[model samples]
Target: MTYRIGYIVGSLSSVSINRRLAGALVALAPDTLEFFEIGIADLPLYNRDLDGDYPEVARRFKGDVESADGLLIVSPEYNRSMPGALKNAIDWGSRPWGTNSFARKPTALLGTSSGSIGTAVMQAAMRNVLSFLNVPQLSSPEAYITFKPDEWDGDMVTNESTRAFLTHYMAEFAAFVERVLAHAPGHIGDEG
Candidate 1:
């Protein structure tokens, strides 16, 4: 019952706290989910002029979006909005007009930040984008973490409450993915 999930992160810094938070989730994700991080750092800034003949990277990224059953977005607040790289990835996946790869794909938003805001505003912006693509998103059990540097010892999320919270959150997201797959055309796990 494993679901393939396309993953994206909002930060590009070499020592991004957002990346570490995503790593923690990866280490904690359940067996029912298989994550594949799609690197957006290599993508050129999205431009409509290139839509007619998308770059190799753009085509590959679209293919990645199409093949996955769902998406898991990990973000950090950047000046009260989503990072440009992540926004560019979304734009690339949404285009060439009426061929959005994300339409109807189940998605969830999880984010962390040192500030109290915790990417709430950024996720809101993403919500509007995904809504336009007709993608389904998880709205319950929100993750808006204010990260602490001392909260881990490599990969593991050491805080007991945070670990417990994420364990349940993953289970909830797994259920959401199942519901989405059941509703999708040519649902993957269906048996005729």
Candidate 2:
């Protein structure tokens, strides 16, 4: 069965290295996983006042999150933290009290950066937030890629080692999603 995987690239910049990494990861993913981007560029800075009546864009974003079988967040580190736009999207997805779109979803986080540490700091911060949101995240094979221009050709990771690692990561993610979904409440496989 094909799984609908929604991915969020945390950079708004057109030339974001994280975006390229996300695309390459998608290309390396298993055939059963179909990926779609969940755009965060247009989401306004989340305000509690808007919670009572969420904007159309925010509603659409929530719908996308709820519809996905799993989620992938690819982010870049900015000043030792995740980009503000990505945080904003997270806030929106977890808001409107009791309507968190991310709750119980099988999620995976990975990122790329020019720094030697890659996006470690950013992914750590995201892990805390996602934990609070009750997201079931893939905890193994943590991917923190350091971007090397020579190793990449546009949206493809040209280096054999990097490509192999990403391929394994995607396969793990696909298995994680299926495992989570099989046991989810109301899933066909569930005993109840």
Best model number under TM-score = 2
Scored by lDDT, the top model is: 2
- The TM-scores of all predictions, comma-separated, are 0.93, 0.95
Show model 2 residue runs off by greater than 4 Å.
Answer: 185-192
What lDDT, from 0 to 1, does candidate 1 have? 0.83
- Please state the error at residue 75 of candidate 1 in Å: 0.9
Give per-residue CA lDDT, model 2, range 1-192, as digits (tens): 889999999999999999999999899999999999999999999999998999999999988988888999999998888899999998998878878888888999989998989899988988998988888899999998999999989999999999999999999999999999888831121110
In the range 1-192, model 1's lDDT, one tens digit per residue, is 889988888788888777888787776778999999988889999999998999999999988888888888898867878888898998998888867888878888889888887788888888887787788899998988888779877766799999899888888888999997887753232111
Pairs clashing within candidate 1: none
Candidate 1: C-alpha RMSD after superposition = 3.8
TM-score of 2: 0.95
Model 2 worst lDDT window (10 residues): 183-192
